[model samples]
Target: MSRAAFYDQIETTLDQMRETGLWKPERLITSPQGARVQVDGAGEVLNFCANNYLGLADHPALVAAGTEAMGEYGYGMASVRFICGTLDAHRTLERAIADFLHTEDSITFAACFDANGAVFEPLLGADDAIVSDSLNHASIIDGVRLCKARRYRYETRNLADLDRQVAAARKERPGQVLIVTDGVFSMDGFVADLGPICEVADRYDALVMVDDCHATGFIGPGGRGTPALHGVEDRVDIVTSTLGKALGGGMGGFVAARQPLIDLLRQRARPYLFSNALAPALVGGAIEGLRLIAEGDDLRNRLEANAARFRSAMTDAGFTLTGEGHPIIPVMLGDADLAGRFAVRLLAEGVYATAFSFPVVPNGTARIRTQMNADHTDADLDVAVAAFTKVGQELGVVS
Candidate 1:
């Protein structure tokens, strides 16, 4: 195709996005990820959209750890793990993660995206089957598509549907069966019904896998994640998570499972075998983050308190919120245009947040997704609540 045709096609698609109100614009942050940030034009605003659950994104300890690692291990690895990229810090972080999660072994990846992308292709084949939750993360969906396994999707958080799906999958008589879900759905903050799911999997002799990216380092006692939260730590067969969120808010991911499974992944997982090793600074910072999680529950308690405060205030302000009292609180607005305007109004009122609409979420369920963090003070929450209240009332979303 000619360059002019290519340009015209791209421009037409961009026009369609703008016309449909689906165009997403990036907000430039002049400050670090925290309870408050400075946007490019907006001087400063309370941030309620970050995934820094434990307030460690800008923590001094993580900074120190990253700085120390830079001095000790230098900068980039320049090669993948299978080559000469593996460092002592990489192995140490992998082992630390395994110990933290009480798993037999673990393998690091460049990101949780890669970890999820590579997991299914290596473990399951044409003769196997995968039973997934309807609302599982997109990465899992893509991973399942890449694999040759027969696929089945159960209704979100519905055990009866899961049972039906698993039973149906069993009729195929596949070599192996795996049930996958996110520990905590990112958009709605609904914790997966892992206990029931595990029971179903056990009855059907299916393996259970959880992507605990949103729950790790903040959910459950000792922050061991949703498997522990649901009393199925030993029952979950595979776990994948990221260091990009609560774990110091850096970048990297890992898959934790039994020794043999991790060993097989190391040999066959394309993301692990082909991607460049995780940076040393991230590995070191994450190791420190894990240490912090293992050391105390103060951060977790603070985070939970913040979430409770925000949820209660929002509910009291007469806004409908989806899911339970978790950090990810979506204040439902229903209309995509209204949700977009609500977010803009929020930013103007000194609260920074983003709205979700169709394609990202179901239609007629547009909402402003607010994430609470340990770093947010009572004053900060009050400020955000006031903003929401004012905007919600002005927009006639609340009485």
Candidate 2:
């Protein structure tokens, strides 16, 4: 096709997206990620949309660590790890992560997205089967698509469905059966029932893998993640998480698993072998973030308290929420347009949150996915509660 024709086709698709209310527009933020930020034209707003659960995104310690690493390791690596890009800092951070997760070893990736993308293809083959939760992250879904493994998907957090899927996959006589799930379902903030899942995996002699991107920093004791929360840290075989969320809010991801798995990924993972190495700043900052998480419970306590307070207030105010005791609190609105208007009203009231509708979430389950952080003060939370209440009352969502 001609270039003009190609351009016209793309423009028509974009127009269709806009008309369908599916196009997502970026909201420009002028300040660093934290409890409150300066949104362009919106001025300062309490940010409840970010994944900064532990609030270390703009922590002074992480800033110092990054700056120090910049001076010590210089800037970019300019090459992949196999090609002279492996720094001592990278190894240090990987080791720190492995120790944190109680895994044999770990391998770093440019982002959790890359880690998830490169994982399955290197490990599972066409004869193998991967049984995954239907609501697993998009990255996991995409990664599974790229792999040659026979895929079996079960309903979200449905153990019975998982058992059925596993039994069905076993009928294929695959070499390996892997049960994969998100440690924390991002949209609804529901922590996966890892213990039961682990039991089910053991029944089928299948290895369990958890993508703990949303739960890595503060979901469990010492912030060791969902496995730790469920007391199945030793049962889970592989864990993939990101430094971009609770850990420094920088850009880096890692896969922590048995030494053999890590070794294989090092040798064969395409994204790791082909992509540029994570920059020194992120590695250094992540190391410090891990240290902070390992050494103390103060931040975790504060974060839990904030989440509890917010969840209680929203519930008491008659807003229906999904999920258990996780920082991600989804205020269920049922209707997509109402959810969008709710978020807009929230922003107008100086609270910044985002609405998740169809495609991102199931249709009719539209919600405002608000996240809590340690840095959010009681006053900030009160302001947010007031804003939610005002909007909920105005929209007749709450009596």
Candidate 2, residues 1-399, lDDT tens digits: the string is 999999999999999988876777799999999999999989999999999989999999999999999999999999999999999999999999999999999999999999999999999999999999999999999989999999999999999999999998888955899999999999998999999999999999999999999999898888999999999999999999999999989998899999999999999999999999999988889999998898799999999999999999999999999999899999999998899899988999999999988879988899899999999999999999999999999999998
The top-ranked prediction according to lDDT is: 2
Q: What is the TM-score of each candidate against the true structure?
A: 0.99, 0.99
> Which clashing pairs does model 1 show?
none
Runs in model 2 deviating more than 4 A are none
Runs of candidate 1 with Cα error greater than 4 angstroms are none
lDDT agreement of model 1 with the native: 0.92
Please give the CA lDDT of all the candidate structures.
0.92, 0.94
